[model samples]
Target chain A: MTTSTLTHLQTLEAEAIHIMREVVAEFRNPVMLYSVGKDSSVMLHLARKAFHPGPLPFSLLHVDTGFKFREMYEFRDWITKEVGAKLIVYRNEEAIKQGAHPLKLGVARCCGALKTKALLDALEAGGFDAAMGGARRDEERSRAKERIFSFRDEFGQWDPKSQRPELWDLYNCRMHEGESIRVFPISNWTEMDIWQYIRQENIPIVPLYYAKERMMVKRGAMLIPADDAGNLKPGEVPEPVMCRYRTLGCSPCTGAVYSSANSIEEIVAESAIATRSERETRIIDHGSNSMEDKKKEGYF
Target chain B: MNTLDKELFSAVETALLRFTTAGSVDDGKSTLIGRLLVDTKGVFEDQLDAAMGVEDKKGAKGAHLALLTDGLQAEREQGITIDVAYRYFATPKRKFIIADTPGHEQYTRNMVTGASTAHLAIILIDARKGVLTQSRRHAYISRLLGIPHIVVAINKMDLVDYSETVFKQIRQDFTDFYTNLGLIGGELTFIPMSALEGDMVVTRGTQLPWYQGQTLLEKLETAPVTGKINARDFRFPVQYVSRPQTEELHDFRGYMGRIESGSVKVGDHVTVLPSGLTSHIKEIVTFDGSLQRAFAPMSVTLTLTDERDISRGDMITHSNNLPRVEKELSAMLCWMHETPLTPGKKYLIKHASTTIKAMVTSLDERVDINSLEHIAAPIELKMNEIGRVSLKLLKPIACDAYANNRATGGFIVIDDFTNMTVGAGMIQ
Candidate 1:
């Protein structure tokens, strides 16, 4: 019997696997940047498949902002244990002590210290020369031009104007002593591709991605989780509403959409007809060219 | 999920097409892409609103479609595309990935980066300008990169009264120019339309009623997807050796790599190159299960019937069609760095799962982008310059001509000191 051609998903899977193996072969110290999101879940799964019998040769680094939803933390711990790979979770305790919150310090500065700086610190401490992330080009405008093996200077800065010319599937992973490369295996995948792959692979995701009755309070255009009802201001109250997260981040910074589709298949259906982008609900991504600014500042 | 959603997912799974578009800013490349996205409902409401904000600030009528693609802050400030930006859209028939490359002379490296993997190249030409020098340069680069199909989009037809004569003349000019390059066998197509008026892109509008050719989207959707290689030779470069060393799989020694081209089956005799050892394919493995056979672009592991000394940088092929084993080869090199490529200097050549020290023995000639002429015996190739050169590798690599197989034939030149990819090379 003649063998049929591989599907688009299979093609994507093979490309991701090839990239993972290349990093492992080339870099001395490599790690997976796991954020416990749907993209991260798929990435972690691909990592497992990349080296099936052998355990993951690299560790997983999660830069915790100390502001994620409780369910996300639980899922992170569970999956880490399930995959049996070493997980490195780093938090900026100094920033937390200084009260660096999004509301007080603004989203940009807050993310600078808690996220970008923390990630750099983690990589530097681990002495990792290559860090693989799930950042896709379809997520944002600036990302659409990024290379699969995005090079970062000693300061972890991404210079859009002076990026190396990448061609074909032959990625150049060479770097100097202090510099590191950010490898995005799924750089070509779109948002719809991620959801459908999750459905097809039966990847486990956080419960918050599914609709449920939760205590939510309307904050401007976004609906944020009101876990502590006592923090409500005068004439502000928390109400039970059906909500799900299109994308996940810090609970305070991420907004939930009103939805009734509680299953993966339903999420796929909803995502196909989605009129707004997944990042529109992200509170930190506001203002024109803010993502580029943050990315230049070394945010993942 | 409903029946329609299922059908949509199945369609999305069927195939993926990647193409690149090249044109100067005046040629409306970005506008054509924006029109395709908008007409296909790929653009979200918020994205359109953002584009509208930029358009309103510029005092332009309707939405400025070009603003949608010049995504970077610096690009928006300068009103020029600086690099390759990828865009995605899908119809029920197939999905498409667009590599939107800039058309300036200095950014030829970026255009090559976009066209390197594209199956088709869409070279946009302003109808009024006819075939320009920049257009010829882009078409030449697309041909150099071995893109299987070429679509010459004669845009802005409305400005020329939608005349069929103008379209045919441009097409004739391009065909003549392409023929002078001594090229053969690749597909060439031409279409006349106006992206601003939304004619002959995604929808067939009334203005283009005189044309009988397929629209741009139709050509992209129905293009051939596979078996473009010159020979069906199985070439698998060993990437990583997977030895689990577990309790049950203690003896499980599998070689992992992607099948770069051709196909392989179980029980087939294969030879490991550079080592010259032979073995029979015992099993083809994946995370899901074992496969009886696998084809190009599929990543899998193989268990040999006999143990052989094989590691990364080694190649597996059948004896019937073995790739050429070469220690020195000639190639067409595109210098991508500011530092000129000097002869007799050692650089790292990363080709097909292997990195070896290689030195440029000589610079034969540089191609003049403007005239398409060969300037003989260039001492060194500067940035964004293409030349023919000979290289001596420290070790032998099993390779093929770039025209035969891109995956096995193309490589990148990395600087030893800076570790940067400074040049791209295709074996001659």
Candidate 2:
């Protein structure tokens, strides 16, 4: 922290903390959506700070796709224990049993089935009126104009066109009986900011971010782990390669890039010089498709 | 070829700056944002491909840069921005959040939403058309919202043959009009550029060698943020009172909220507003540790020496210094709902964690944005109209001028029955 001034990370942190405090104060049942990523770590930290000297009022909700990196789960459990917060994990097991993996069902269909559907189901089951997502405006073009308190209807549909006017610090927590609001605290934070903040706060993220000698394979244009979750198509081959992930999602769907950066400072310096966009490595956001479609289907 | 050094770029400043773009639809607000985002490399390749694909299908000339900002499906179908879309980008110098509000005259309420939290407002103008009514209206609204800085961008310079004379004339007209409008304070800068030809946006173009000013990006990077850093009297609007009577940390009474203004250290004499109960700050608590001093915008818990019954809606400030407490408030209300704001109508007014039932006593005057004249004795204000309205609150509210501090003075009106936000109010 600067002596008298706040850096951009601190500013974003303050804004997010303010939002979280508002959520717990206004909403009936608010949950913080934890994806066990760097953004989620920063978000959890801010949420903790939002209500200090006392236990956090909200529970952590992780929409389990059942195909995450093994290290991510372990790290998440450890963090939950350390923070002494209850985590309510949700999943759509029926869809997974029906072969709803990304490789089998394709990008939108599979993400809609496992990620988006699971979240909507979880919200319905938990009766949560408000949810906090680590959704940043700089992450995707479609999210650029999303309201901080984005409204979702009974069917969990997000209409980017018709959103409440969030003026100044006044966020509308007034939702209908079944409707909910998806609030993003880190809406202004960029990828670099997340990495920088992680380094500053020493946020313990998954090991997949740092380059290591791990089992890997090539899929079309992306480098994926050889452990394909039993959905490897015909003619696919497995091999060992040194790589790291720019983003972490399901193992089969998330692409890994070749890198040597291992520490937070190294990754920050490397990511700063990296030319391609962070989402360029993810297959779901590839092609002519945008995340707005998935968001409209309630993909937090 | 103005590529900043890699080392300089890597040591990027994390200071954030938020600004709003305002103008009429044809003034190219969207195009300007797209150009800035694209030039800053904020747009990914795939996103650019989608926008280019849309342009190709339309057989449009150039890259159709506005597609980058007009993101929603309806916005694409109508070729207009309907909501306030936030766009983000960063230079090695700073990160920027752009409140890209719709430029249509009907969306002035949305413009207020975008500009209310903004530190600066970039009012775009078509050099060929000079300062139009919509341009003046946007500038007036931004000023009313207390945006500390203003940038009058004379856009579409390419269409006017890159004429310096046209840029100067528009700048002079805006200065004269704004001075008449009494928006004389704050820093005002003018620039001539084309969002299409990329004359003086992110990079300087050879076509505008006569325009000897920094590019828009440079001006934004160098704009002073220190003015807002000055400390004021302490004012912390109570968001919640935490009493986590636990085993180890018993009697942990704390008032939680982000400081609206000023700084507070331990042992400072403070008064809870509307209550005026005197106390001293005992501790400033955060998740990480205790803070010796906390400043504005920092969300922290402040424990007082006395356990006063402070709950939400009560504000804490310096004992000697207090904001004006009143029941009747005169403010500029930007009508947001379709139902016209009628006098003697009851609504819920929410301001700084305080929600109270209030009635619109009278509409003193409505401004004709086009003519800059006040329509006296207006019965009601329709959607997107700005009017001076007096509100009688059921309970007194402690507030500073919206110009003095937006966090304490800005408010919204919700319809009593529908709960829809009907208006955005700035206390005069």
Candidate 3:
């Protein structure tokens, strides 16, 4: 490899590592928000690399919406076991008991209460001063304006118009009492980069990402995976089909694509040629301004 | 991968650069990013499949490379970047993080956010549209943000028949404007390319035979970005105080911070700012081990020989090369909020690692972007406008001229009531 090329890679890695270290040093009670998605998996892997001879200094915080795919749980458990990091699952049992499914209360409200609010409650309960997320700027419009060290008020609200100027990587993680920051080390990474890194690093992921024979039902333009957690309407019928998920969210909200790419290499190849965005495949974002509205309410 | 590949990957992983692309709409910034990714072979098969499907569904011709960057549904439907989209790509040479910022005037705040940490700025200009007001504004902002390098990409050459005359004319126009703005410093390179046709993006196109210059990818790979941080002034904003009461290492007191500028070594005499306390650097600690010397941008904990009252928000610097410590300061400010910055309004001012209450004393002059004229006696600084302002701090701050040190010279104003960032100011 050319010296310049090697230098460039070194620079990116160093910057990311520095940011990760800052997250650990700045926040008093910090936690890593693990979603078991490809980005989070990569984040977990990078966290391990950031502190090489030792275990991660912070615990993993997962806001379980209670409607997640079984594969996600398996992946989450497996990662926690492998990393030996403390895993704290935050779930709003009240919302689940209230029958706040996607069909009943809509994807936005369900996610707001079950996922975003649950995470906020967890942070409050645990007195977490900072939470590290795998949110990339390329994901959405509101996300693009996010700072590496995004400050949240006591209410865990994100004010897009009034974001701190994070010049020269000198991030100000200082916040008032009861306030916190949402740190993103991979804010610069895109979807393609994530896939490429996953392929190159050979990071372990959930099997739901790979195509397999699963019971599915066509809904609108998406292929909805039929699972025990997903409730079927009167007109909906499940059929056996080969499918895989581009993004993992709630089982009912996350849609599957018709494909046969089972391996990491195959997934990378398919990702290059896929027409829809990873978010587009997810049924949860079908609502108008769902993701944006969720983010405003302190969702990562 | 072999052992050599593993080593190379490790090295590349260690060194990464974040850059932002800025310009007015129709400058082909998105297309340029698409070309970069496609040319570098960063686009995987799944992504390609999705792009092809979108192209087919929309009945659009060409590759629709912009789709790769326009990730949002609204952005795709509108055919304009509504936000700052970050795209990452890695070649065998280097890994890059590209902040693809929107070119619209309304999203100026987004541009600032993206360019905040960028080492370089790729300012795109449509060859047809010589030098627009927005282009000038972006260049000024890029310079104000203290990006080390600037690459002026003259895009859409195919629309102008790849004319050397057009490229030269545009370059001359930009050079004149930048000269007048006093913002064109560091290694500035001008490249002509057609982002739509992929000319001079990854590989030099044969069509531009007269333009004998490196391709966009080649230039990015070979660009000199080594001398970023100022080596004269050592500034470290203490983030935390690490005191392990463990058995193995009792009485271990280290001040942790990422080096913002310059370098620090063991036995170097350093002075803590704000308190004016002096001490010697006993050790430079890292996750791996202690280092003999640590430079800017490296996050390490420092063990001082003296047990001074050093804490977060306090800065440690070379005693001989101390920065100006004052309560009152002057800066060039950009108003980013809808609410105007009024004089005497108390706000929270955040510098490197410190946050203190501050109030605007006076609005010296407002800059008219189009005419590049200073409007004296402006009452309020509106959104997306630049002005010179004086501020009085409730507490003293140690800072340097932005031209000398970016880390110490910048600050952001936050509303005390709402706690929203209202404006960004650079010390003059």
Candidate 4:
């Protein structure tokens, strides 16, 4: 007979489900920052589990950076309907109008103007009192200090030094007006946990993670996807290559590895022995303290 | 399933060991965590190379093992961890989650947060300074939190010339002080180690040949984790009501929540506390499918054959075992903010999903964390101070003792004016 003890995956799932319920019970108007990545997919599944037989209490908000891959859009639309989630999409139109491209404006400026600013503007306009993201502590070093219910100022910036002391499972969700909390349901889960949960639960993710022949242009050890011209540098020509993305982001900034492992089984096996950190592939993460800098600017 | 997937699934079935490292600065907590990661192959080549590059910046000779865990820019700049950094490592036998916490007195709240859910604690004592105040403070807090196991890891043995007498003296001192606290037995463990020299951490290095006990990793892998997590009377605090009212499931009404303790199954008679209504468990619903039985820490939606006024903040329990409901509460409180705790100020007491206005009517006494002595009738509890207090609540709460169950017994005090969490209270 199997023992009553919960597996590691089940433990992570339980913690995440508890967080979802807390947000719905505490906040006035809450929303989910659905990035349509593996983490987001697992979070969406957990949310549904948290409030089964009832609609998800919060709306799913996607801050479109105007630079995601073509597959991300399709996946977003399909998954939202599949789970019957209330979906909201927003973007900073001024940046798109003024031509704030990644290469032209540079990685830091482009991410700040297009991504972080867009998220801030969306949160403000929607008047959301709480927002949940799939940020895990294992992803970044600074995130290791993050509280489960991370408090944000009126400007939506995180203060690492003065975080409220969270003891036991009793998180302090009390906040004044205009000040919101960024709730990370899966703060304890690692990257391997995510893939394992996804595989076990059969949660659907973007096919961009699977290996296939794709049009890419090599740019300094990175396979810049040729799906968008903005991703290519000047003298770069589109070529065919077999690759898959470890982590997804802006089409211009995210990098793809030369991998032939296509199935979920293959990916998990390959990742078990893979040496590179998942964040290493993203161009924005190359700069020292870029993640902390972006987070201070209200980036998710 | 394929061969690789099956192997991974079997590995996932292993229990996760959650432990916290508590020691003052220079006790080499970070070095121990770094060596554990390295020995387990948890650190990648790229990460090692990155740490190697920071060796010079940190002004160390070799690859500073501390640099592997001191991940933040501020931590590296100050050469001390400012917050709890969780590190993960797995040997084929088991997986470990290290809550590497800072030992500064100013950051005691961080350590409390880290120790809240830990199954075991590693209270490191520098062999040079036998049983310092910080070590005793940490061990006392761990005991108060009801952590099942405590390992007093006597570290920095190399600096103490690996003298068995020094290690034994510190261990004996810790024992004498720890036993007088009237704590439960079979919870204390002693081990001698040198984190910087990589002795008795993950491996039994040759330097500590005088000691024959198991290494740190071996102890972790084989330690009988003691109490069961879900063996108790059922307590499920209703978190949300779920009713889709769709055509496929028209008359569906399920109350969703995570079982804080114990287990429940279909046809089990349960009583909804704070209402005194009885209902039978009709169904247990999950996204994947329905579970025949569910236990603690599992999130599930349950439907009852008899419907009553059950919503968020209401608890479901076995009919024979009901919790005490009272308007007056006596608890041990840990102050967490700059604002001092006054006797007559109004504050919001949040227990589970219920928040009630409460006032501290009496300040009984404070515990001197260092000497474990009582300071009677303290004026107020400052930041990081633990004391006994009496509170009068406007509304009654159904609760059990913290020693009986943590979820129902623990509460937080929210400031009336700022709404910030100011204190943590454990129902006595």
**Worst lDDT window (10 residues) for model 3 chain A?**
A1-10
lDDT of 2 by residue, A143-239 (tens): 8778888888999998876677789889777767999999999888889888888877888888889999877777767888876547466777778
Best-fitting candidate, scored by DockQ: 1
Q: What does DockQ come to for candidate 1?
A: 0.72
Among these predictions, the greatest TM-score belongs to: 1
TM-score of 1: 0.97
Q: How displaced is residue B66 in candidate 2, in Å? A: 2.2
Residue lDDT tens for model 1, B218-268: 998888766343338799999999888989999999999999988899999
Candidate DockQ scores, in order: 0.72, 0.57, 0.25, 0.63
Model 2 stretches with alpha carbons more than 4 Å out: A1-4, A286-290, B1-13, B54-62, B226-230
Clashing pairs in 1: none
Question: Scoring only the second chain, what is candidate 1's TM-score?
Answer: 0.97
Docking class of 1: medium
For model 2, what TM-score does chain A reach? 0.95
Instruction: Look at candidate 4 and tell me the lDDT of residue A253.
Output: 88
lDDT of 1: 0.88
> Ranking under TM-score, best-scoring first?
1, 4, 2, 3
Residue A165, candidate 4: how far off, in angstroms? 1.3
Worst 10 residues of 1 chain A by lDDT: A228-237
CA lDDT, every model vs. true structure: 0.88, 0.83, 0.78, 0.83
Candidate ranking (DockQ, best to worst): 1, 4, 2, 3
Local accuracy of candidate 2 as per-residue lDDT tens digits, B1-428 = 12434453344545778899998778888788888987888776666766677436446533478877777766788777778878877887888888988878888888999998787889999888998888888888888888888999999999999998888888899899888987756788999999887779999988898888888999888886544533576679888888888997898899898887778889999888787788999999887899898997788889999878888999999887788889999999999988899999999988998889999999999998767699998988999999999999999988987777778889999886866778899899
Task: Report i-RMS for every model.
Answer: 1.5, 2.6, 5.3, 2.1
lDDT tens digits, residue span A1-300, model 4: 234777778878988998898888878999999998888998999988788767788899998888899899999999899878889999889998999988898888888888888888899999998999999887767777788899999999988777777776777888888999999999988777888788888889999999999999898888888888667777899999999998999898888999998988778777777776787778887666467677877877
